[model samples]
Target: MGEPLTIHLPDPESAIHLAGPGEENLKLLSKQTGASLVLRGQDLLVSGPEGAVNLCRRLIEALAYLWGQGRSVTSVDILTARHALDTNRTEEFQALQQDVLARTRKGEVIRAKTFRQRQYVQAVRNHDLTFCIGPAGTGKTFLAAVLAVQALQANQYERLILTRPAVEAGERLGFLPGDLQQKVDPYLRPLYDALHELMDPEKIPALMERGVIEVAPLAYMRGRTLSNAFIILDEAQNTTPPQMKMVLTRLGFKSRMVVTGDVTQTDLPEHQASGLSVAQKILHGVEGIAFCQLGRADVVRHPLVQRIVTAYEGHE
Candidate 1:
């Protein structure tokens, strides 16, 4: 065992901020680094084997950017810090802390919470077309929507179109409800939910009416050249090869498209191939197109959600 390290905080209040709510962040740091941690007054005591102590020290340093500024730390912050230390990408990790993607209507700051998520954001920014494949709760759809909204608000794009394959409802909406939107809304609720998080819910109707924002089933994209738009195709795994090709071809001048899905959770028939999978195989090395694959580690939801994803992966 090495000598215990005593790190002094800027203030007593900052201890609680660094420790996280109920000290969950400290607990996760201890678990990840095998270090003993205790907060007393204004000092943090870390004691363990040499390697573990050093890791804990480095992780705390990496997270200093957040807590030092009085921002509350989260489990996602802890996991990301540990990952940055493990992969020797501490500089990139610090850079991510400064890269806020967007703020919610309620004033919550949104940023990439993992290395892969950062890469995904860069991919969306640098490429005209980007594909992200990941499990649930990895912010695959949310991040895309956030960027899309930011670009739309900045006038970078004339319109924002969010679409997904309505495979569950089979796109047979004529029998369902009132208007075209009301009929299609059941399958498009997730996209709506994402928009609501990024902008005023009350303003969404006005935006939709003015064609500044459009949320619809993937089928609605056919034969239309989507120009000057930022488009997000969510739940893309439900799309067949043809549908995927149709949408890819619809990307018109000055338009950007982000396609996100979890291939493992496809609702397609066993014999049918997921468009996402097929696209990955075919468009992988194509120029001006970027593909990002996020694993269970990229999950930024409740920590339990990461464990649940792992458990299901093991069972599968």
Candidate 2:
């Protein structure tokens, strides 16, 4: 171990925030940087190799920056700080810490956890149309829905539309048991789940009734111009070429569209080509549209899910 180093944090309030609840932040910082840290009053005693000590101090400073901004520092912040420290790129880390995508009912934040995710969110914010392609566990649909809800809540858009290709329906909408709405509701459950993450589940029905929020099967989108709306097309890989063309054309004036899908997970028959795959080729240089491809590193689910995606990707 290197010689002991003492760093005193000036403010008690910031010390609390930097340390996190039950010193979880300190523990994470120590573990992540390979430095042994112990808090004594407002002073932190760090003992490790010189390199490890420097890393710990940098992480502590990063946490202080976030805490000063009233942002909750968690284990995830440690990861971001370490990445920033390693790459010597602190700007993205600072932005990621401050990017408040959405807050859940219990006040948990839902910001981008990775650097690429921050870029993805920025793409969604700046582009009129964006294509997010990634595997499971990436925040493609969820982040798009969060932005859609925030835009609707801020009155940036008059409506929030969520739709997906119900490939399983297979032109049998009438034959599917319940009324038009009920039959398609099952297919759009992912959108419902996303909405519930941003707002109260009870409030969604009233919004849907008022036409402010529309979650429906992709079939209902035909021949309808969606104006002044934030629309998300999930499961685009399941859409046929005609279906993708129809939906893309439905984006009317003052509307933004986000198409999200994992091309590798296409459910279409072996003979059928996924519209998402085809659209990427046709619209490669299209103006006003952006495509963001996220790899296994972008998977924000459980750590094991990231490994699973990476393993599968390696095989491919």
Candidate 3:
């Protein structure tokens, strides 16, 4: 092992932010870089093999932009910082650190927290149609919803349309209680949850009534030309090939579409195929389209979620 290296944080506040609550962020740094870290006051001492120590130092430097801004460090930030270092995209990573996509109703700022997520957001901004396929908790649908709402509030689009295939609601929808909406509401709860995070719950119904925002099952999307709107199709992995084709063809003038799904969690029957998978194969090199694939490293939920995804991937 080489001599220990000591880095001084700007202040106690910066030190705390970098260390994270319960020193979890420090633990993550050691785990990731194979270094030993001990924070004493404002000094962070790292000791290990020369290569590991140097890498740990570089990772910390890459994350300086965030902690320098007094922002709290998170697992996502650490993962993205390492990714930026690995890919030599530290300059782009610094740019992304300053871009806030939107703020939540609770006043939390929302931004891309991983390398692939930033790419996905940029893809959505630059392309008319973008598809993001990843495992759960990677912020695929949530980030799309955020961008769609931002476009709507800015008057970039006249309406916002959210749709997904209600896989179990095909023929059994009529047998359920209430009206068509009530029957489909269960299938659309996740989309509603995302909307509620950005919009006030009481105001959402009014928006729906005025047609400013529409949420419906994929079956209701047939025979319609959607224009002047931002459209999102979530849970797309459950859609059949024909259903996917119908929705893709519905895109009209002055509109944008985001398709998000977890291909591994498809609810389709064993004999059926996932439209998301088919579309990826068919439209990969097509112009005016973008496809982003996120992996376990992109998950921004609880840190344990990343481990769970890795475990499942290994089993598969």
What does each candidate score in C-alpha RMSD? 1.5, 3.2, 1.8
143-172, model 1: which lDDT tens digit per residue? 999999999989999999999988887767
RMSD of 1: 1.5
Output the number of the lDDT-best candidate.
3
TM-score of each: 0.95, 0.85, 0.93
Residue-level lDDT of model 2, residues 1-316, one tens digit each, is 7787898877677677778889988887888988998988888899999889988887888767666655567665677678888898888787777778879888887899778788889999999999999999888999999899999999999999999988877757888898888989888888888888779888988999999999988888998999999999999999999899999999999999999999999888999999999999999889989999987767776557878988888899
Among these predictions, the greatest TM-score belongs to: 1
lDDT of each: 0.92, 0.87, 0.93
What residue runs in model 1 are displaced by over 4 Å at the alpha carbon?
Answer: none
What is the Å distance of residue 232 in model 2 from its true position? 0.5
- Looking at model 2, the pairs that clash are none
Off by over 4 Å in 3: 169-171
